[model samples]
Target: MPKRLIAGNWKMNGLKAAVSEAETVAKSLSEQSADCDVLICPPATLIAVFEEKLTGTAVQYGGQDCHTNESGAHTGDISAEMLADLGCAFGIVGHSERRTDHGETNDEVKAKAYALTRANVLPIICIGETQSERESGNTLKVLTEQVENSVPTDLDGTKMVVAYEPVWAIGTGLVPELSDIEEAHNHIRATLTNMGIANADEIRLLYGGSVKPGNAGEILTVSNVNGALVGGASLKAADFLGIIRA
Candidate 1:
């Protein structure tokens, strides 16, 4: 069975004060039965600190992005090895924000994914379309190409996670209907299976964008959706836990 994972992405948000929220989340999950895996990706600056705060707790810390190189001259870039060293069991690659703002390409994301795999850090690869593409009926076309290029042929589903967060839906309060999410995830499953992985349904797929506590349960039950890639709600302890409960 696919693991139920609720991943909170802190994005560009988080400060000294935000550490307390993560501490609370860690405590809450630690105190409860571990039915679902709870992970949080704060900004790179908070990775080490949050890891320290999350020690001995069920809550795990992750990084929003990681560099392909294990060590290099890439200024301002964090690496998968470093994330693992800092206690991050997972990392997110190719988020829409990184694709749009960092000029990351499919091949670059793929390289990062492979690097994460080699470093023993799970990479949550993201792929989605913008409003324009959806308007033009190119959603599947875009998603297919991304999956074809972003996911490596050799990696098994256990090595990483995939998130489908339509660019427009991210941070925009606009989400695709349940059917649309199902279609995208289904297409992803087919694409992965064609690449030679069996039991691909056990691959964890997350729905990002506009995900909150209120709508989390409804979305989680969607076919093949293992959990969520939450954004805004992740910044708050209460809302983040609510989603985990959902």
Candidate 2:
């Protein structure tokens, strides 16, 4: 099995003061090694500061998003190359918020993911069904379409992480049953294998959405659930550490 990755997505939150939270996580990990890999994705503005503070520590940092272009006339957008230059080890694409707010399509997400691979940064591609889709019994269909359209086939030896973040559950303090999570993850794995990824089994599938320490251990234990894409709970050192410890 591949090493599990517990990644925190700080989203549009975080300020200079939030550096202390990351520092504490780094310090704790240094003192006591974690069983899984630890990563924190702060907003783009804080990546450099995290790189400086988290260097030589077990914790890794990354960007929340990146542009499909390396460098361009597109204003207010940061490219994958620029994120790699700032020491980002990974970048997230196709997150629900991005899809809803920025009107990002699967093709655009595929382009962005490919750009990250070219920049030598791993891409964490987000895919999930909304509540209506799930209630309508279209969860697996939605995942299949997203996987086929958003993920690029030419990875060029770069391994991309896929995060399953159910849109309705995000920040709603609601979580799916263990059986539901298992089913979704299994379907995702099978889909990847059918897509001809040579290392499909080795690829990590993360479950995101209202993942707190209270449920981290149980959720992580589910088959095919290799890790988590934590949100609000990751904002505090103690809460985040508790999930890590789980």
Candidate 3:
């Protein structure tokens, strides 16, 4: 069975107060996490603290993004190997914010995924369309290309997870309708099947953007949505645990 995972991407958010929230979230879902994998991908600076506070707890911690290189004078770059060294079991790549703001190219994202795969870390590769693309009724077209371009050709489904986070919805507190989400996820699943992965069904496909506890149960119950890649709500432990519990 595919694991029900609620992975929080506390993107570019958090600070000293985040520790208390992280602790509370770990405590809140410690018991129920056995039913699902709960991960918090805090900024690089907070991974160690989250790991320390979540020790022996159900919540695992990771990083938002990592460089393909292991190490060197890549000023302000954290590598997958380093994230793993910090006890991160997962790494997120190709998030829209990175693609837009930092100008990360598809090849760069693919290289990053390969680097994570080599480092024994699972890469959560993100793929989605923009508001313009969706409005143009080319959602699937965009998705197929993004999936083809962003994912490493060498990666099997188990080597990474994928998030369908429409750029239009991220942080806007808006989500695609359940039908839209299901359609997108199903398309992604089919793409994986064509790749010849044995446990294609078990490879996780997460929905991101405006996911909250109040709406998690229904979303989690969707046919091919094995989990969520949460945003703003991820900042607070209570809010995050609510989604896990939901």
Query: Model 3: residues >4 Å from true position, as ranges?
Result: 31-34
Sort every candidate by TM-score, greatest first. 2, 1, 3
Q: Order of candidates by lDDT, top first?
A: 2, 1, 3
Question: Model 1 has how many clashing residue pairs?
Answer: 0
Give the Å error, residue 107, model 2. Answer: 0.7
Per-model TM against the reference: 0.97, 0.98, 0.95
Residue-level lDDT for 2 in candidate 2: 66
Candidate 1 TM-score, true structure as reference: 0.97
lDDT of 1 by residue, 52-120 (tens): 778778888888888999999999888889999998888999999899898999999999999998899
The true-structure Cα RMSD of candidate 2 reads 1.0
Candidate 3 residue lDDT tens string, 151-186: 765666666898999999998888889999999999
Q: Which model, 1 or 2, shows the larger lDDT?
A: 2
174 in model 3: Cα distance from truth in Å? 1.6
In terms of TM-score, which candidate is strongest? 2
In model 1, the runs with Cα more than 4 Å from the true position are: none
Cα displacement (angstroms), candidate 1, residue 240, comes to 0.7
Candidate 1 lowest-lDDT run of ten: 194-203
**lDDT for position 4 in model 3:** 79
